[model samples]
Target: MVSQENGNQSQQTGGRFAVTLPLATLRGVGVQLGGRDILTDVTAQLRRREVTALIGLNGAGKTTLLRALLGEIPYSGEIRFDCVHGNRQQPGHIGYVPQRLRIEGNLPLTVFDLCGLSLRRWPWFLPLGTRFRERVYAMLDAVSVAHLLDTEIRVLSGGELQRVLLALALEPTPELLLLDEPAAGIDFHMQEEFYGLIGRLNRERGVTVLLVSHDLTMVSKSVGHVWCLKDGQIECEGSPHDLLHGDALARIFGSHQGVFGHRH
Candidate 1:
């Protein structure tokens, strides 16, 4: 675990991913779409500087919950973000990495252009200023994508693109980070590296993370806490060791022996 509070360090929260308190709280979260109930009374707390995984089978409303937290969808519940350290105002107070990024591969935009595209003040037609380009390069370097700075967006493979997206999400390092199926398209080795990077960020930078993934094996090993969502509601929650056995994980997928198989 990273250092939590050590005198003056606990008060500092800039240029780093330090979150020294419960950063997000959810209560009675419910969502309905097209008159069909998608989520019901979901409640959970995102601990500071810890990786928490949300696990469930496909169509279990995991993505819906993430969307609710992102404020992309309307929900009938309370989602609160507490002010961390001293000042809460800054660039990228919240960062998110979605499951898939759809971009035109043939677009001549280089990785450097993509990194600074969103942060640039002017429209896409304007040239990226020097300061902005340098900042983008720094962000890419954080995720080890600096070498691909001039590579076109379309040329990036599955793993490379994910790294770029992660670097973008962490530009300036947000206090709260959300990831949805971040390793969906990568192989096992790439997934390991990807998650390893996330763990390092959590431990070293103290960024609070909420991860939605189906990789039970990796999630079980990486996250400090597990929230099992089933049929749109959180069925159970605890440490990975506590919830990975018997019916705890089984029920999360609405199956007895199919999802986890003999692993459980």
Candidate 2:
């Protein structure tokens, strides 16, 4: 039990903590599409310098919830960011890498072009000065794709394309990074390498990461916290060890038990 004055002090302390830290808060978040609730009454708090994984079966609304956070989908909720300093509206503040990188038509856009797209505020189309070129090269180098700067996008493999997309997302040095199945459809080695890079990015950049993935093994090892979604609701959320113990996983994902099996 807590006293009234103590509760007030605690609340004040919590507010101060929020203001000081680089965190994002979502309260009573709900998303409905086509008269169907895809996400209902979901509440989550993402802290800075930590990785949060969104894990669940297909159609569990993980991607939908992420989209809502990006303001791409209409949602009933409050998303407050503790934007330190004056760099709040910058594009690099929230970087997103979508699931697929399929671009149709045979446009001869090079890797440099893909990276240059991130420089929307620049007046010239291509990277003109040494500073801009260095920045692009640095981003490509960070993803280990600098050698392919001149390679055409249409000619790159799936894994190569994913790297380029990641480079684009990291161009602005974003505070919050959202990755949707960054390892999907790639080979096992590439997946491992990508995870290593993501881990380093989180650790070194102090970037808050939110990952939506179906790979339970990787999710269990990589993230500090996991939010398991089912039927448009958060079924359970905790550390992997706590949530994946014995029948708890079975309860969240019953007979169809695969990586993130659906209960039925």
Candidate 3:
């Protein structure tokens, strides 16, 4: 078992893989879609084994910031991941779970089919061999969705599908896990359970998590650090206790009254 001291050191060093290397850095990050600024001058650093929550309103550019971090969208910024081994030519270090994955019913695929697709082997359509099958089963068991391995994608509910996606993402044992509202659209009870699972993963696997969430209450309970966004900018950033009990939340989101409550 990994000791707490080791975990803390791993986190301080930005995970085991990059422990000896310089930390990952994001500087002056900015993004614009169709001449509209979605993320402006956003900068942050992600440490290993730390859960960072990105919170904001419906259109506060949280999703845009996540995309920018993944390099999925063009943006002006420097995202540098320093590898201790000096091997920068790999694609499995970062794992991403997208929000609202629209799986088409017409696609003839099973849960196992999607999970096997995560393998980095050539010819993605090739059938999984015994070794790969074992790996797939292990991943399914890890996510507690082994029973759904044979289930059809079209038949699974939202929460089941999300678990399948998480299993696929974890197959690579990514150093950095990026989740965009993993609990959205699920039932209230399931949301609570899902956050608990997420918290466990962070604590046990030492996977650094950065989640973009609008559920402030849930996020407050799950994450260690919070970065609140508003109008394409960071309104406030600190611990959940610091932002919630103080005037920071009221200043950013209190004036805009609704069921959503304060912003930060």
In terms of TM-score, the best-performing candidate is 2
Model 1: per-residue lDDT, tens digit, 1-264? 111222223433564434554566677899998899989888776677789998777677877888887778899978776645323323457788887678875679888877767666677887777887788878888888889989998888888988988998887688878898888778899999889999999999878789987777888888998888876777777888888776665545545456632121
TM-score, cand. 1 vs. native: 0.84
Give per-residue CA lDDT, model 3, range 42-159, as digits (tens). Answer: 7555555778898877777877887776768898867666543233313476678898787787888988788766564769766578887777888889878889888899998888
**98-163, model 2: which lDDT tens digit per residue?**
976668759898887766665746765444677777888898899999899889999998788888
Among residues 3 or more apart in sequence or in different chains, the pairs in candidate 1 whose N, CA or C atoms overlap within 3 Å are none
Which stretches of candidate 2 lie above 4 Å from their native place?
Answer: 1-22, 85-90, 124-127, 259-264
Ten contiguous residues minimizing lDDT sum, candidate 2: 1-10
174: Cα error in model 1, Å: 0.7
* The best candidate in terms of lDDT: 1
Ten contiguous residues minimizing lDDT sum, candidate 3: 1-10
- For candidate 3, give the lDDT: 0.72
TM-score for all models, in order of appearance:
0.84, 0.84, 0.84
> What lDDT would candidate 1 get against the real structure?
0.76
